[model samples]
Target: MSVRTQESALRIALVFPGQGAQHPRMAAGLYGHEAVFTAAMDEALELLGADGERIRSAWLARTTTADFDDVTVSQPLLYAVDHALGRMVLDWGVEPVALMGHSVGELVAATLAGVVGFADGIRLMRARIRQFAQTPAGGMLAVAAGLGEVEDLLTGQVHLAAVNARRQLLLAGEREPLDRAAQALRERGIVCRDARARQAFHSPVVDEAVEASMPDWLATPLNRPRRTVYSAYTQGVLTDDTALDHRFWARQAAETVHFAPTLDRLLADHDCLLVEAGPGNSLSTVARRHPAVVRGGSEVAPLLPDGAQDDVRDRRSVAAAKERILPLQQPVRA
Candidate 1:
């Protein structure tokens, strides 16, 4: 693909979803048809060794949710699929001007943006997952309330995991407090659903895991991102001076994911075409609802279909890409 000047470059933004979006046999259709995607998946499986086989079997079996419920299994599998899908989009000549990720999905963005090598990213994810699995098991609740509303109901035990949107907040902690908080929210006629997370990610409950996994995470080499990377960790764009080291990642695991702020920054800075490069439209759905996205007339698309229709999925992706190109040629305004 030819490079465009700063003024004329297509400001495309690729967004990835984290956990809670995984399902069996996701992107099974694109695997065989797209050579670049196939190579990426095969390489990821090879790097994973036995765990690779386990993920592959789970993908093929398409059986139970338990197959992906394990953090160790889900993290690597999601990374592999998300990375491959991003590569497939690039092969289609739809290069991103920026990238952002939700929670664990940041690993994929980091790799694509040249912050870390592909293999090292996978190793870091595996180590992170294993350490998380060793921690005390907890739960997360998706509360339909703003941060202020949820904080009003919080005890000393629970922590805010993610600020997804104005009304979408994820609360994480021990089962007892989580349940209590959910009950309290429900009593007020607020919607609260179980996130079904195996561990209390992005909360103080995983401090032990963060400490255990620090050495491996720090050992992984990192550089300045080749493209702009919006950080859920800092709730802004990652700059040259921003540290992309072990401490940063550890803090990320133990801090609230400021996804809404990151989205706001993306919309304010660029005329971005937001593409969800994961199993489902989870992130895309959220992007569409953002006031900035709606007012800016930003286009959002998903790379894979929710169902088993492989042919239809391919057609939709192609059509969406074609549609994205036209609007991207227009001048961007804040």
Candidate 2:
């Protein structure tokens, strides 16, 4: 295909990974190295108040102020990093056809799309922490098996949490029960790993907590997305009404995430250059398994290094992605 033909066929979609993608000091490489990203991230942290400062400290120091998956640190830091990266992408002059996010990343998508103000999004996350405080302590498990293969194992406390890709599934439950479930899956020769989660999100354990937090929202009217925003939770394009539904947001953690189905729908709409605009490359890793990407109908770019802190490498990755998306325009770096 000619350059023009290939460019014409491109439909860019910015995808953000959620909770489990967080690591100690994730995306530290880009903290002060990239101007646009640094400013946006700082703004996000500032809105988060004192807690944001603490999170920033840990992130920059490559240490943890609390459990890596604790709601206080992980959720806020992940949200800030993902949001900042999205802003950086927008600054590149490339318009995304859609914004999609997994789990908490969906809120980041919603914030960027104008469905909710950024501060309001942060408040909702805070409310989530407060409300879930009373719930039973729980966690999530990442399993390398299809839902159909493991659905029967979810008992009273255990439940299917998320469908990341074709065979990658997530299970959530109270800690003890989740551990038992993992053991059972292992006995059946299925690979399983504990997700970095301090709570059993997307499980019944948090249902009542979610219900109690439904009223926790500002009176500010929700806005329509400036661009298309696909929802992993609903597995469809998010409607304006759903965006305005506080109850819907409240029940998010008590429901399963249909990320794979949503990705299928997003891809069916058009082939895309799927960019991972968050810490690590988990979503990009998942997207690579999709048929269109494997068939060369789509491309994927992850902006940060996967396993370690490398400021220079991070800048190079962003610069590389910038070139891939906008060859004629020079990036802020390189």
Which candidate tops TM-score? 2
lDDT tens digits, residues 1-334, model 2?
A: 4463534466778999888888776777777877888898888777777677777776776555566677767877888889889888888887788899998889889888998888887777666667876788899999999978887888677999999998999999999999999999999999999998888888898889877776775444588788899998879999988888877776787899999999999998877889898888889999999998898878788877785676777788788888777752332211
Instruction: Give the lowest summed-lDDT range of ten residues in model 1.
Output: 325-334
Question: Candidate 1, residues 82-197: lDDT per residue as tens digits?
Answer: 99988877777666778999987887888888888999978877776678887776778888888878777666689999989899989988788888888988998999998847
- After best superposition, candidate 1 residue 5: deviation in angstroms? 15
Task: Give the lowest summed-lDDT range of ten residues in model 2.
Answer: 325-334
**Candidate 2 clash pair list:** none
Q: What is the lDDT, from 0 to 100, of the residue 216 in candidate 2?
A: 71
Per-model TM values vs. the true structure: 0.90, 0.93
Give the TM-score (vs. native) of candidate 2: 0.93
Error of 1 at 314 (Å): 5.6
What lDDT would each prediction earn against the true structure? Answer: 0.79, 0.82
Superposition error at 43 for model 2 (Å): 1.5
